[model samples]
Target: MKKLTLLFIAFIAILSFTACTEDDGFTFTAKPDPEGISFMNQTADTYTLTSANANNLAERFVWNEVDFDVQTPINYELQGAAEESFSSYSVLGDVTDNNLAVSIGSMLDLAEEAGLDNDPETEAPNTGNIYFRVRAYVGADAGNVVEQTSNILTVSVTLPEATEDAVELKRELYLVGDATAAGWNPDNNNTPIFRDAENDDIYYFEGRFAGGDGVEGFKLIESLGNWQPQWGINEGAATSSDILGGDPQAFPVSDDAFYSFTLNAADGTYTFESIDASSAPTYSAMGIIGTATTGDDSGWNQDIDFTQSTFNPHIWYINGIEIFEGEAKIRADNDWTDSWGDDTFLSGQGNNNNDPNIVVTPGTYNVWFNDLDGRYLFIPQVSE
Candidate 1:
């Protein structure tokens, strides 16, 4: 009787073990954390969806179909203020081998595949505002699923707004002697500096040469024009009074005549000096002192003496001397036949006498002429 009882007890224990084993297969339990569901509203809009948890579902938490009844899956929708909305759903691999707990890493991978892996706390739209939520499920079984919704995360973006300032200019002038005599307002205290139309920041000064005729007197001309602010005695229409009749008119021979101007602004300053050479005359010589003709052989002919003239000549001279001290460095000496004379000397020269061109930075400048002709300095307005 004891043996039979022991056998029955063994049999009962086997049955209980079999029943427990059968109950373990494919059991679906909604996990606390959804496996693969993500949401993002890059646009200025709000979005919401149901998600399934797979914390303890393991491999049974296979997502068959993610239903976003109101929203489409893996779609980008444009919203106001250049914002966008997006949703994604993914199925994680079977977690059955890993017991009842589904790996968080797997859920993250599934979320990434579904395009819902973005961080909800920091997710933001490019402009305007955004809101996001998620939904998940297990396999195709609606009965075996869990829904997890994240808090609505909002992000705002704003667009940025063109720029203006004061004008600046830099000017340089080349001339003979100091600039004060040239009628240049160094500080623009007397005359206002003119600004360029194209660029208001640029300023220019007109250089005028004091000489004969309109060309002989102080005439403000363009830099590219035929005249310049130099102090050479030329034998043409551009000749200064000091060069024509030996008597100084606009510029005195005793003191070197120079051009000068002042700047109104205190930002910076520029200095321009004229270069002198030997080809052009610095001062004019009276006909008497430097005779172009001599008396008759009998010594009875009329001897023209410019020095004896009572009237002051308009010629350019050096301290009552007939000879000019300064000359032009760059000279084009040529002979031409005129109606009144033959073999006339014609020369073309530059103020600097060295470089034909010069570049200056933006600033105020005191322009001056050295031992050069005042009619050769060409100051032009420039822009960059």
Candidate 2:
């Protein structure tokens, strides 16, 4: 009787151990999903990235931490697409933290890249919908990954007009002196200090310098190429930390290698930094010289020069101009070295400088010249 009772107790203990093992062996077949992913601080209305708030923080996207039920770190990536299908998307960045902060400049770039027109002015403003999604993944690396994407969010974006700010916006600085290609004449042949097309207040100049020592001095001037307002080393500042106007000290360089100069107009400071050979754009500025007849052939004989659009070096524009069916052409400094015209001037199709002069009918028109695509357009407006 004692032996039989002992056997029964051992069998019951074995059964309890088996039940515990089965309960602990359960596993999840799929990776965990991130919950409550959203734009925590985004505005409901269309966001505007203007000159005033370009550098400000634009948006913060937050999401709850996901648990993949595995002993590994999870990676998060923020992505955006022009369409909801997300056939192709741009990755804003990756973050291990639960929230991601994006700048206004970054958002503007994404909007423009996704086909938002930069034109600030129109009867109907240019805008488009941008979709955003967050993707989370886990594994040692991308090779052994299990990824899940969040629900899509749509946002409307408006693009600022390029020409609207082209005049008032000081997006470029020119280096003028005997040391520069312009040779001390701010009004002629000035070498430009370029700013990123999307960036504001930061300018860059990369080129060979023949002089930087005391022999030939260089000053920074706005695109007007005038010396009235200029930038130079501040008085009694350490290592040229500040820029000042009114007969300021010129910047000195080593002049050993091709130099790159960066001026932060926003901070009122400047720096000399090294740059790659292919860092800057090689596009040249163009001038428009043409004849517009409102009354007697008054302006016909004179060469009317168009100013370079402040936002785009390749774009030239003439605003509020009188036109009476005459002739017009685009040229460099009113010289035939580089010029453009069209036999079919009424048609918007682009033509090379070698083409004939464009014929027009009498009216006031706003002209736009695009050197990037060799295209030109004439839009008529009521005289004011």
Q: Identify the candidate with maximal lDDT.
A: 2
The residue ranges of model 2 lying beyond 4 angstroms of the native Cα positions read: 1-30, 34-39, 51-54, 120-125, 141-143, 162-384
lDDT of 2: 0.59
Q: Rate the local accuracy (lDDT) of all candidates.
A: 0.27, 0.59
Q: List the residue pairs that clash in candidate 2.
A: 119-161, 120-160, 120-161, 177-184, 325-361, 325-362, 339-353, 340-353
Cα error of candidate 1 at position 7, Å: 3.2
lDDT of candidate 1 at residue 148, scale 0 to 100: 43
lDDT of 1: 0.27
For every model shown, what is its TM-score relative to the native structure? 0.17, 0.34
Worst 10 residues of 2 by lDDT: 236-245
lDDT of 2 at 107: 73
lDDT of 1 by residue, 207-279 (tens): 3223333333222211222223222223322222212222222222222322332221112232223323334
Q: Once model 2 is optimally superposed onto the true structure by TM-score, how far is the C-alpha of residue 46 displaced, in angstroms?
A: 0.9
